[model samples]
Structures are given as structure tokens and as C-alpha cells.
Target: MGNDNDIRHGRHCVFLMHVHLVFVTKYRREVFTKEIIDDLRDIFASVCSDFEAELVEFDGEDDHVHLLVNYPPKVAVSTLVNSLKGVSSRMIRKKSYPSIRRKLWGGALWSPSYFAGSCGGAPIELIRQYIEQQQTPH
Candidate 1:
């Protein structure tokens, strides 16, 4: 249920900002396993915490991921995206995910491109439905 009550209050502002983010693997390689996705979810949650944001929902396929983030007005989407992509890549690479390591030998986990859409004005249920519709590869 979407409501104005969900809006957050900062020092001088009250706002409700949500973004749907999608990131694909470098060259669109199928590198995610259940373990990898689990690790990534944790990583992304931590990153969002650092920025005082909430990672509302997260899901992924073998080669890409979708994130529903609720953030404050002060945070720039690009900066958040950069940190999410950068920190997660570094942390994932440090771990021993053999398949991912082999495919991402060049040291880049995500492609330079990403998809970001604001969901603030849309009804929360609609946003949730859209995210649920994301295709999960077998």
C-alpha cells in the first residue's frame, strides 16, 4: 500500500523516493549462482545502510539483478549506483566464486551500463508487481 505516511522526514524535508535499479554482468555473462546472489544481496544491503537508505527488495537472474531502494533526497542516484556496483564487485571478487572469477577475469563485474527508474510517484503495489515479473533464469 502506498501512502504519504511512508514519506521520510529529514531536517527540513519530507520525501518518498524510490528507485528501481538493474545491473547486468560484464558482457552479459551468466555468472550468478544461488550462493553468489545471496552474497550480493548482503553486500547491497550493507552499501545502502552506509548511505542511510533502505534496500526494499532485491532479486536477480544468472546475469543481472534488480534492486528496489528507498533513499533520501540528499543522496544522488549515480553516487549510490557507483558505490553499489564498485563495492560489491570488489567484495565479490575477493571471495572464491570460481565460476564468476573465471568469467570476470578482467576484474569488472558489472557492465558500465545500468537501468534506473524512479518509483516515487507510482503506487507501491504496481512497483512490486513489476519487480515480481522479472524473469528468473533456470
Candidate 2:
């Protein structure tokens, strides 16, 4: 059985999927302010919604932002990340944010590489133990 609370009911299937993402500023520059982080939160949420996903949590320091996203199986994580990065970069810079664009070396706001990890599932050990305990009928 699966965790009822976490599973999302789709038209044909019940599933749960989550991924934690981290995006760092290009060259690791410490340039974000409170206002910038807030903007990023809204931007990411919007992007997630476009893909039928939810941004469960969002926060950041000066140079990096962390996101916890729950998404449907149809959405590819790479595509989602690409949109999140591309749209946010364009929107935030094109706005009246003068200091941010100047701080970046190039037109890009985020680094090319990012960190993504699967989360919100039972540990592997527990699954192994359950399998081991299963009875084999004679």
C-alpha cells in the first residue's frame, strides 16, 4: 500500500512524485535580495502550474534558490526546469531590476548545471525488509 496522503489521483492512475531542485546564480554571485527571492517564488510557482505541478516550498539565500515541486508523471523534469529557469531569468531581468542584470556576467541569470533529487518516498531499506518478510507458499 502507498501513503494515501501523498498520492494524487489522476484520471487513470494514482501516483506521487516529487523533486527537489537547486539553482545557483551564474558564477555563484551573491546578488539576490528579499524582493528578488519573492519574485522568484512567484515565478517558479507560475511555471510549475503551467506544467500541472505545484511548488510545495521555495526559499533562497543570496546566490541559490531551493524548490520542492510535486508534479504529474507526464511532465518531464528537465523541461520543467528549463522553463523555470528561462522564464524567471527573462521576467526578472526585463523588469525594473537594474542591479541584478548588472551583477550577472552574461544575459543568463542561472548556471547551466542544476541539482535535482527525487524525494518523498519510503526509504529503500524499508522496502527491502518488507520484501524479505513476504511468505513463499509451499
Candidate 3:
């Protein structure tokens, strides 16, 4: 005979979590073009990788951006968002897009705030699926 609790605890637990993140330009400015978006994507990926997360799907218009990311259990949402925004904004202004600095009158390419949500339960997967499906021609 064996203890049930001990047996249950013997298994390794892995949380397959996905999070959807949205970051917008300050005051919803139309600053991101195709070239800018591509540069930001690469910058985001490199930064996220340092935090033990992976950037899954990313797309955006001129004003805002949407990113689907998978992260390990140890990562905090705020830290992740802050790092992405801080680093990307700095890089974009300093190196990639200097015009943003001139237009914004400051060195801020992105807004100070961001939105992040976990996609574990409810209609999260359904929402991501819907976004994916929209790529098809109507």
C-alpha cells in the first residue's frame, strides 16, 4: 500500500501558458510602418527570449500592436511587459526610427502603459484562433 498524496505529488507539473499582450503608441499615433513593425518584432523577440519566453504571433497596425507569447511559470507579467516596452522604445528611438523622436517631441515611441492577459481558460484559445483565421481572403 502507498500514500495517495505522495503518489500525486510525484509527477512533474508543467503549465503550458499563453499570454496576449497589447502595446500602443503614445496617444495612438500612426508611427509604425511595415519597416518599423518588422524592426520592432525582431527587437521584441530578442528581448523576450532573455526572459525565458517565446514570442509566438505578432501583428499590429499604426497605433497598436498585438503579441501572443508563451512563457515559463517563473515569469511575472509586469516585468515582461516593462522590459519589452522599455527596451524596444529605447532601441526604436535611438537606432531604428529617429524620426519618432522628432515627431513626439520626446524619446517615447510607445505609451507608458500596456495590456496583458493570460490565455489559459475561457475563450482565449478561441480568440487567438479567430485572429489566425482572419488571414484568409473573404
Cα lDDT of model 1 by residue, 1-138, tens digit: 368678889999988889999999999999999999999999999999999999999999999999999999899999999999999999999996998877877789999999999976777788799999999999
Candidate 2 global lDDT: 0.91
lDDT of 2 by residue, 67-104 (tens): 99999999999999999999999998887576676788
TM-scores, all candidates, are 0.85, 0.90, 0.75
C-alpha lDDT of all candidate models, in order: 0.94, 0.91, 0.79
Per-residue lDDT tens digits of candidate 3, residues 1-138? 123322212135545667899999987788788888898899999988998788989999988999998777688988999999999888888774644654675667778888888774447677788788786776
Better of 1 and 3 by lDDT: 1
- Residue ranges of candidate 1 with Cα displaced over 4 Å: 122-138
Which residue ranges in model 3 land beyond 4 Å of their true spot?
1-12, 96-99, 120-138
Best by lDDT: 1
